[model samples]
Target: MQPLSSVQYQFPLQSLNTFGIAAHAHAYLRVTNTEQLIGVYADAHWRALPRLVLGGGSNVLLTGDFSGLVLHLALEGKQVVGGNETHHFVRAAAGENWHAFVQWTLAQGLGGLENLSLIPGTVGASPIQNIGAYGLEIKDVLHCVTVFDPRDGITRTMNAAACGFAYRDSVFKREAGRDLVILDVTFALPRSWQPNLRYAELAQAVAEQGYAVPTAQQVADTVIAIRRRKLPDPAVIGNAGSFFKNPVVSRAQCAALLERFPALVHHAQPDGSEKLAAGWLIDQCGWKGRNLGAAGVYPKQALVLVNNGGATGAEVVALAQAIQADVMAKYGVALEAEPVFV
Candidate 1:
């Protein structure tokens, strides 16, 4: 195997991410297949190399130029397995664009991924954080993930039960970060999926239009429209959709906060904790549309931290820290950043 020292890197990741934070990786690996991945990790130069796996670069903020190889997953493959119209099985490569895949599935009349339309990131990274939007999460439709485990250098398959998916979190985001390199993801999307009209925004939009049973395409379109209105196009503006995950707190804390504010916005979770809307808290604290240095909170989305023009990663991180501190000081809620920072 050739040394990774000769491997190429397209440096200065300024425009790769939604938030165009200027950062650079000393080494870059674009692994297009399982064999390439093995070669990448086996290379002596890359073996001890500090590395970062980059996909579409949608949900991350690089604080500075990495001094190691940045492995970019560019693998792409998609297919259908078994099952009739009622249920369908599909597999997608990690490098596949997430929004494009959702659109393609909708074109195929697939219903499961419609509600999560327009989310950014790659197929491989989707299971990393279990990306969720609208009223659906990736875990709802996920069957298994094909991962290249670094522990013993073997490929392993994991199901949802082993993924440890929670609200915007999974094992990949926790202690499993560098342990696995997601190869492909398989999902069991149902054709006869009934519309989930639970989220208030979606419900209101449907009721206002007086639609009783909306089709999967309609759901995809609606969700896309809503997201478009809230999130700035990464091509137009630099941002990582939501800067922080919604904070889930103990029921007791929710009760205490609701009693104090009387109109505190909170979602009841099946778990014992109450999900606090991070946006609402940020908005309440007047972080919405607030700008500091080159970083700013998106005007329409208080939860999103935006790069007005050429914000440094450190600048964005500082703003996030300020917002976190403010929310914690005011509401006793700690805001956790969504982007995976190395």
Candidate 2:
């Protein structure tokens, strides 16, 4: 981590994370190329390089100083590398800003990424979490991801099925995914269009906007508006967007809940599974806007855990544990976190 101004010392990571939690890194690196990463990885200090990969830093909550090297991806580019019967292949660098890339795709007349507008983070981090918002997930648009294997020190690409995409998760996030450092990602976006209006709020926006059959860009605008209404702009207030993934349960488990709370809301999947509204459950449990120490649930959205200043990572983790334990005990359903804890 020496002889490199690209690497900084005692860097405050508060501005990096959306939640704006003040923290520090023993050392930090802004890797703009694979060669740069390999050079650093080959150092004899490899055994001691406290490594952390970063993109937009939106979906993370920084509770404390990371006693390691945080490598912030700064490489950026976008292009169309392939095509298919109806969909065209659009490729983006790992460090490319996600929303900017989505807007670019819309400008190029691509359709699939529109619903993902205004989502924070980078293209590299998107696949690992299988990020979803407004009824659409990254898996639907992913063709495959090209990654540099840190273990074997090689490059490879894995297809969608191999990603093992599930609700807000993928194999990349699994034990294997951690070994893979994302270099770039390729998405399959349809050239011809069929706008997805399956999301209730989106449809309502279409109706309210008087768009009989909204164009792809129009859909994106409406979705952006709705998201702004729900999720706080990280610039204005510290936040990590939604802090928990929706609890996916078996049909039988969902049936049990429905029997108890007839007005319970859920979205059914084709695989005979159902996704419970996690925000609803949190609110029903009366955790919304309730502060514990310095960490608390967002007032408007329960699933979003926010820092009200002076909160430590331990405090945040404690609050999350309380919420998880309460839900498990009350409804027999477990809520999982979306942020990857280091």
Candidate 3:
């Protein structure tokens, strides 16, 4: 067993988080294996303190220094465990980089995760947020999630149905499953590969690129190109990708809004609900390229909030609040931030 003495005090976290907020943890442990998790939870002194399980740190905003024990999940590995008639089963550790994992799957001739290419964070965080992009969500390909429960000191596997996935939400984010730490995720990629070009932009881009019948790798490449043109790389400029979820509203509400704002951008869900484009709402509120303090809305994509330079978590939160307030005032629709504020 690794000793608790491996834990460090007041660990700096500016580089860990994509937002680049200068925050520190009271105690930090770089967990390279499951034994580290068990060790931390078994110790009474460590267990008494609040805990924050961190992955690639792309999906979190550190508003201030965390007083809890930061368990930085660095576990890594991925492989094709098995395959059936219709799908190929692949398993990846929670700490594996998401985009790299998706690329690895494609490199192995798998197809289901192509549309989700270029998404940030780790595989473990994928199920928690049900991360989606272009036209695919993690729930669409996730077969099962392995989680460790500190309460019982037991590891268990839960299927997709048990995850309770909705738009950018899962049981992992709720009270019932919050205490369970993710270990790994297994994805059932289709054996009979097909390109998922459901989004018009992706389809159009593929067409423009002269790929009438695109392969999974080609589709992934296109998605990657599109993302690079719109989103800022965290290494160059700090950001948490899309800052808000596209708010879903009832059909009638959509119709009413459409009547008033004919140019409103929305998509009709299969469930008869309307999903409005959060970027469009924020843009209409006249927030594009606007800055409050060191935080600013990305001029190219209003859905993204960027750190102009050395932005504090409070500055980002304040900017998000202002955008939310503006959208609510003009469109009567509330915008919800996507990142977990820690």
Candidate 4:
């Protein structure tokens, strides 16, 4: 067993999380390999404590000091593992930066991940959140997930279907799979790639940039530019990108809302539902550029809640709740937060 003495107590986490909230964990371990995970799980004392599997810390809100063990996943590696007749298989260790991974794939001439460029977080967290942007989601390209089961102290692989991916959710986020820790992710990039410009804004941006037929690299560059313009860099301003999940409502509910809100922004889902833009709803409620304590809505984008400076987790929660209340009261649609509160 890995000695408990290796763990650091009262470890600072302000720098770990993108939100920049000042917080600490009772015990912290920097996991660089799967053996470390096995060792930790095998230790009875460590197993008894609550655990937080932390990656890039982009999708978490630290409500306060964590009274449990924080396993900081720092494992890193990525490569073009192999290729078949129709696709190229690329695998990345869980802790590799998400945006960097996308860029890396593009550098290797992979195209499928271009539309998901510039998303913040680690590749490991991608499946957990089913992170998406510009109409492309991780699930669209994910081949499989490798995980470590603490209960059995065994490492295993699960195909994409087994992950149970949905919009901003997966089996990993639910109670049944909470104890399974992601070790790495494999993506299957199509060989006969075509640009995905299904999203109107992305298509318009490409046209404006004079790329009648954008290459994968060009699409990634465009995506990076778009994200840079709207979202604040976490290093500059603390925030989790797209603080709320775009609520999915039935077609009838959307039609009634459209009647009441003439300019409501919504998109038709394949399942006959309507995905309402949470940012639009919040902006309509006049929450954009608004502040509640040190937590405030981003001036350029209402979907983002930023830490103006010295914001606490409680303060961010308060601001989020306020926006949710206003949006629900006005549109009768409940907005769910995308970030997990720790």
Candidate 5:
């Protein structure tokens, strides 16, 4: 087993999370390969301790100093496994940057991921969230997921169907998923690429750009452009992409809300439910560009809550709670946080 002494103590985590909150971990380790990961689990010193498995640290909000072992997966390798002339199979380890992987696939002439460009986080974390943007979701292209089950010291692959994907949710987010660590993810890309412009904003953007039929590259560029205009960059100002999921409500509830606020933005879902824009709800509640202490709602997008510099995790949580309360009182819908709290 690897030496437990290699674990860093009282590690500062301000730079690790996107929120830029001041936090620390009791212990930390960077596992670069499955052997190293196994070594960590085998070590008696760390075996009984509480553990936090983190990826790019984009999808998490650190509430405070954690009294547990923080494991950062850094495993790296990627390849085109096998495919016929019409399709190709691409795979990447957990540590791979998600955007870079998307670009690499585009470089190889693959096109399904164009709409999901510029999303922050790692490849392994993608399947867990079933991350989606523009009009495409990872579930649309994911072929399989390989995970290391620490409980039995076994690694296995689960196909796309078995991943149980939903809108920004999967088996990986449930209780049964805690013991499994994602090792790598495989995607099925089609050689006969098609650009997706299902989202009205995206379709309008492409049309405004004077393209009746945009290529994959053009679609990706448009998506990045839209995101930049709508979301705060984690590098410049600290924030997770979106603070809340769009609230899905029954048709009767949506109609009731529309009666009160005729300008409410909503989308009809396949299941007959209506999805109300969480950002719009927050904005309507006058939370945009507002703050509770140092944590504030992003001016450009009400969906994002930002650290206006020197904000504590508690302050961010406070702002989120305030917004949730106001939105709930006004609209009778509870806003669910998008990021994982640790």
Candidate 6:
């Protein structure tokens, strides 16, 4: 096996993760190209160790130092892979910054990704969470994803249907995807664009701004403006955006909750389930702006859990547990965290 490139030992991770958790990987490797990835796999030393693929670090929390190999996918590039008169197909490397890629698509006059504007993390991480915002999710635009299988040391593409997408989840988040590493993703965007104004806040903003027929750019800008107001910038504060998944309940459960709190924020899913606003539940339980040790719920958005400087991962986990228990006890709804705790 050839010597692998960009390898390091005992890498500091505070700057890498958005939460600013001070943790270290036993060993780290940044694979810039497919060849480097292949070489790493060819080495028995690396092949035998457990591996974790890290992208932009926006959607993960470090519970403690990682004991195995951490592969930082630095591969980067994008291109118009294919297209039709009605749609355009574009492919982007896994390491591409998600927000920048969205902006780039907008610059190219592509329409599908606008609703997902300003989301943190990388293209690789998007599919795993089926990341969504302002009424649009990644599953809507994703055409296919390219993956590298460590077991076989081969690359392959899986179409959208094979992704097994659900709310904030996909096969990549489940057992089926453990052996696969995301390499790049292709998106199918409509050329004949229609802005998604299904989200209430975005719709109100666009209406108040007097955009009767909003263009793709206008919609993107509006969503960005709304997110800026509600979600804290990770750069200014240590946080993973939206710490909890909005719990989905049955219609009967929704009716029961409505009996007690008529003004509860919720949306009816097509499958007859109702999705509750996690932030609202947390706030109603009086956890907003509250802290357990060094971790605190963000005062502006109750869904976010923040590191109030020098906080440990255990503290964050404990704070999340407290919030979960309170919400469960009060509303009988379990608030599952969005970020993956490593």
Q: How high is the lDDT of residue 227 in model 1?
A: 89
Residue 267, candidate 1: Cα error in Å is: 1.1
For TM-score, candidate 1 versus 2, the one ahead is 1
Per-residue lDDT tens digits for candidate 4, residues 1-342, read: 556666899999999999999999999999998878888999988988999999999999999999989999998999999979999999999999998999888888788998988888999999999999998988999999999999898899999999998999999999878889999999999999999999999999999999988999999899989999999999999998999999999999999999999899999999999999999999999999999999999999999999999999999999999999999899999999999999
Candidate 3 TM-score to native: 0.98
What is the alpha-carbon RMSD of candidate 3 to the true structure? 1.2
What is the lDDT of every predicted structure here?
0.84, 0.85, 0.93, 0.94, 0.90, 0.90
Error of 2 at 332 (Å): 1.9
Question: Between candidates 2 and 5, which one is better according to TM-score?
Answer: 5
lDDT for each residue of candidate 1 in 255-305, tens digit (9 for 90 to 100): 999987887888888878899989999999999999989999998989988
Find the number of clashing residue pairs for candidate 2: 2
* lDDT (Cα) of model 2: 0.85
RMSD of 2: 1.7
How well does candidate 2 score on lDDT at residue 145?
88
RMSD of each: 1.7, 1.7, 1.2, 0.9, 1.2, 1.2
Query: TM-score: which is higher, 1 or 4?
Result: 4
What order do candidates take by lDDT, descending? 4, 3, 5, 6, 2, 1
Q: Which stretches in model 4 have alpha-carbon errors above 4 Å?
A: none
Task: Give the per-residue lDDT digits (tens) of candidate 2, residues 121-226.
Answer: 8989898888887768988989988988877778899899988998777887788677678889999988778889888888888899999888999999999999
How good is model 1 by TM-score? Answer: 0.95
Q: In model 6, how many backbone clashes occur?
A: 0
Clashing pairs in 6: none
lDDT of 6 by residue, 223-338 (tens): 88988998888898899999999999999999999999999999998999999999999999999999888889999999999988888889999999998999999999998999
TM-score attained by model 6: 0.97
